[model samples]
Structure formats: structure tokens, C-alpha cells
Target: MGAGLPADDRARAIIDLVRGQGYQTIEALAAQFGKTTQTIRRDVNLLCDRGLLRRKHGGVELPPEDENLAYPARQVLNIEAKRRIAELVARNVPDNATLFFGIGTTPEQCALALSDHPGLRVMTNNLNVAMALTRNPSCEITIAGGRLRNLDRDVVAAEARDFFSRFSVDIGIYGVGAVAEDGTLLDFGLDEVEMRRSLAQHCRQRFLVLDHSKFGRDATVRGGHITEATAVFTDRPVPPAIAGQLKEAGIRLVVWSDDATHTASSNGRG
Candidate 1:
């Protein structure tokens, strides 16, 4: 086989193929792309090193759904898409509303977008979020006391759950590690899951924010169901099956594209 494009372009296409179909082989990619076996191996190794994929017995495959990228790695992925979803969610947050925030990159993005929202009280398990929204002095911030996980900069466990119990927030915003194939919302830590559930109970409306990358991704702890959230904001269209499930559950689905929010309901899964 002969090289058809630059190494980076071929590498990207290799990842896309694996992401869509589960896995791909160095031999197969070499044949399809007209590249040598050694060249394909190099591409797979680079992606694996970056935590984008993993080496299976004979082929490279997407990482396990529960296998999270490094916190820093996660923050840089889908950056513009996250900003778009953040804008969509933040636009609906009024100035005087009290809110709850959990941990994860997408929620962090949402907090940043709410910097100018005034007259709000925010109770959060994420210290970074507290600091981000503090840019608006008009908004009071309260952070839960707990042992902080330095990797993700989130406070979790008994104290965090107890602290969230003290307030009835107008909105509870959360990010999932992944949305399961069955439409179940999932995260990684058990304590974080409990804390999120507690926060949800203390809020009047719940908003789940995540990008489309989480679709079909895996995670271990169960946070809640799609029906549990009042609405979900994302950067890509929901697939037909998931859209139907959400619609049947009567949860509003909003997808952002070209700086516009296109809404879909249970009846309009097209």
C-alpha cells in the first residue's frame, strides 16, 4: 500500500473509524488507507498514548466507557461544542436563581458561561466552578467541605451530600461520565453519584449538560435516568432511539448547532 495523505490526517480517520464501528485493525487500516503496516501501528500507538484508544489483542479499539481521560485531556476535547451547550444552558438561567453544580468539564464550562449572571446563590461541589462564577460578585458562592480529589478538583463524600441537603436550589446542573445505551445516566465515583442525587433532590429543576461524545460511552455508577432530568443540552443531534426514549420520558432535548438551539420533543424525533 502507498501513503495517500499526511500522517496526521490518516491518524484522525483511523480514530473516526474505530469510534464508529467499535474497533479496527492495523492491517485493515493499512489496506484501506494504502499505508504500510508499520505506519498504521505508529498511528494506533500515538492515539493509545493520548488515551484516545487502546490496543486490543489484534486491533485498536475505543477505550472503555468507564475509562476516563485525564482531567486536563478532557477539558480540551470538544471545546467549542461545550461552549455552545454552555451558552444554551446558561441562557435559561435567570439572574436571581439559586443553583447546584457537580463535577466534570462540561459543568465547568457551564459555570464559566454563567459568570455575568447576577443575584444568584450557587452551592457547588466543584471549587473551580465556585471561583469561576465568583467573577460575578453579585452571585454568592458556597462550596461543600470534603476531601478534595486533586485530579479533578472536586469535593465529594458525606459532607458534600449533607451540605447540598441544606439548600433548595432553583436549578441543579450536572455532567455525566457517560449516558448508557439504555438511556441511563452514569458517572465514575459512588460518592459523587450520591452527592449528585442529593443535589438533584434539593433542586426544583434539573439540567443535565454533556456533549455528544458521551453517546454510547460507558460509566460505572448510576446517577439517574433521562426522565429524571427536566431537560438535556448537547452539541449534537440525539439518535432516533435515544430521542424516542427521551421523548417518551417527556424530557426536553436541546441540541446546539451553528450557534442556534434546535429543540426536539417526544413527538418530533425527526
Candidate 2:
């Protein structure tokens, strides 16, 4: 029973269980740990506040669907793939266009890749992305200010959303929590979902950048779908079934690799 378990141990157990199952109700979780509903609720709230999990109506779920790890931890995972995907995304942008960079590792990598490109007007809620651009003197960067979230290191309040509403951009680069079988873009937080939707409205072209791991996963909140993107960029070749759906929807799939012929052949499979 959780009564005899240390607080840290109990919290770790809860996290492990939630990660394995995706989501669990408060009552169910409490019963499993032999703790009162109130105690479990406190634990859930604490975890949510720490950006570990998201609190839903009935229970708690893992933090933003695509990323099961905390933000700091996620930046270290898939480093090479994210770097390659970012390079591809950076190459697609025009030199002097206004860019909207969304929150997440992929976007941050893209921002880093863009450091060499001067004369870029960048607007983002991600501190990391903004910082990356600011390191280049020739790049102009604007950060949306609001309540900063520790998990993704981005602003997610109404003020930030309102600030983004004031400007349109040539390109908007976004990352996903997960991609559904039918190409639906998903995330966990309602605020993130709303922010992404708002950003889509202000961009002439939208790009979804993610690794292959993001596919076949589901999130608590649905952002925009693949149809909303001008192109989908990734480090891996997407499965044929998923590629066919994107092709049917008129979304271009761009796989990044040093060997063009190899990439084409690799991407041509189911």
C-alpha cells in the first residue's frame, strides 16, 4: 500500500503506471496504491504542476501525448534524428520570411539550424528557439510573453495567444505530441492545442516536423491534422499505409537523408 511507501516512491510508481497505460482515473489510481482519493488527487496535482502529467476531467494522463518524458529529458533523446530533421526544415524556408516556431525539440533544432540564416524574422513562444535565433546578430526575433511553462519552455497563456494573433507569417513550423493513423495531429494540453490552431491561422504555409516515433501514437487533445500541413518532414520513411493517406490528402512527405536515391527507395515502402 502507498501508506507505507515514501512520497517519492509513490509518485514514481504512479508515473510508471501512467506511462505504461497512457491514462488512468483518479479513483482507479488511488485504489491501486491503497491511498485515499484526496491524497492521490494531491499527488496528481503536484505532478501536473511539475509538467509531468496532464490532468483531465476523470483522471490524469501522461504529459503531452507524443512526449512521455519531461522537457529537459526529451531534449536529450533522439538528438541525431532531430538535428537531421531540423536541417531539412531550415533548408525549406525563404531567407527573409516571417517564421512561427512552435514549442518542442524539433522546432528548437530547426531554430538552431536557422542560426546561419540571417534576415529571418522569427516569432516564437519557445524560449529555447528564440534564444537560438538571438545568438545570430542578423536574425530578428520576437518572443511571445505570457505564463512560461517549464515542460516545453514556452509561453501558454491567453496573453501569448493574443500576441501571436497580431501577426501573419510566411511559414509556421510545428511539432506534434503524436500522429494518429488517419493523420490527425494530437497533443495533451488544451492550451497547446489552441495555440497551434491559432498559429495555423496566421501562416501562409504550415509544416509539421517530427521523427518517425511520433507516428501511430495518440494524444489527449487533437491539434490540426496532417491535411493542415503544407509538408511533413521527418528523419524516417513513413509506413506506406500512412504515406498513402498523406498523399491522398495532398500533403507532401519529405524524408531527410544524405543519400537521395536511398532515401527515395527507403521512403517508398509500407
Candidate 3:
């Protein structure tokens, strides 16, 4: 099924397959996908370095449960794809709009994309997002009060959820730790899930911003489903099942990759 895909796309497919089966040997993957072991090795190596997979003896598997890739590494993984997604998401926000920016490097990129917009009021738990929005002198930033998570450089705790619940915003933008094949959103901790749900509940329009790698990824805590979002911005096409769910829910779906030519959107509800 993955044989005819582009190298990058095939890599993504390999991940989905591995995620489904827990682990997959390079030879098995190569045979299943009709690719040579050498090609599969290259794919596995790239995905492993990106923290999307971990190399086993003769196979690859998902990263350790509940623990995500280091924040710094995540910041650079698929960076160009992130920028493209961020830019497209920012374009949809109007000046002076109030927003809830959730934690994650992707949301940080969104903050950077929104820097050029004037008069944005952003409430976030992400220190990085707050710092990035500082570039926009007109943006009013309100940060949550909680013990900062030094590694992720964000706050995702009960206090953070309370802080977000205090204000209703025009738009809520957030990223998830993973997207289960069944369309459920997953995060590393219960606090993170609570905080994100609070962000979405208070917003008039919730934008779920994620990248292709998020699909079929693994995370411990289950949160709200992706269909809850008013709109989703991603760097690649979603799995067919997910795309159908989004369409059925009347949620807008936008696929804007680094390759501008692949950008597309289907209008739905706010």
C-alpha cells in the first residue's frame, strides 16, 4: 500500500504501520511495502532521528510511553512544515482578535506567524509563545500562573486550566501530543489534557494545529477527540478515516504543506 508513495509519505506510512503493530522489522516493512531493506532502513533512520520512532534490535517501535521527544528536538523536527502550517493558520486570524495559545512548539510557531498582525490579545501557558508574541508590540499577552515545566518550557497543570477557564476568547489554538487512529486526541499528562480542554471550551472558534507526524502517534493520556475542533490546520492530508470524520462533523480541514502547491481547504463551520 505504501510502495508508490513519495519517500517522505512512505516514511509516514511506515510509522502508522508500526504504531498499529507495536513493532516492525525492517525486512518485514520492506517486504510489506514492496521496498528494499536499504530504503526502509533510510526511512527508519530518518524517523528515528526525528524522534518519531525508536530502533529496536532488527525493528522499529514507538518512543517510550508518556514521554515525548525533548522539546528542543521537537522544535526543529519538520520545522519547515511547521512554519507553513503556522503561516496558514495565522492568515486566518484577524487583527485585534483574542486567542488562547496552547503549549507546544507548533503553537510557538503560530505565535511567530502572528507576530506581524497588529492588536492580538493572547492568553497562553506557554512561555515560549508569550516570548514569541513579544515581537508584536501590539499584542497583549497574559500568561497562566503555575510552576513552569522547564523541559517543555510550558505550564500544563491544574492552575493552568483554571487560568484559561477565566477568559473566553475568539480563537483557541493548540497542538496535541498525538492523534489516535480512532480520531481521539492524546497528550502526555492529564493536566495537559485538562488545560487544552479548558482552552477549547472557552473559545468561540477552536483551531487544532498539528503536523503529519501526529497521526497515529502514541501518548498516554486521552483527551477530547479531534472532531471537537472548529477547524484543523495540518501540513499533510490526514488519514482517510479522520478526514471523513472531520467532514461529517462539519469542521473545516486545511492541508498546507511546505510545498505550497499542495495547500487545500474545505470550508465548514467556525
**Which lDDT tens digits does candidate 2 get at residues 66-122?**
445678656855678999888887777878878998988899999999898879998
What total of clashing residue pairs does each candidate reach?
A: 2, 2, 0
State which candidate, 1 or 2, has the greater lDDT. Answer: 1
| lDDT for residue 156 in candidate 1, whole number 0-100 | 86
Q: Return whichever of 1 and 2 wins on TM-score.
A: 1
Mind giving the per-residue lDDT tens digits that candidate 1 earns over 43-98? 88877887777899878998776678867657767888889889988887998999
Arranged by TM-score, best first = 1, 3, 2
Local distance difference test, each candidate: 0.82, 0.82, 0.90
- Worst 10-residue stretch by lDDT in candidate 1? 261-270
What is the C-alpha local distance difference test score of candidate 2? 0.82
TM-score of 1: 0.78
Q: Write the per-residue lDDT of candidate 3 for residues 122-218, one digit (tens) a residue.
A: 9999999999999998999999988899988899866666887799889999999999999999998888899999889899999999999899988
lDDT of 3 at 150: 97
Model 3 accuracy (lDDT, Cα): 0.90
Off by over 4 Å in 1: 1-62, 259-270
- Residue 146, model 1: lDDT of 80
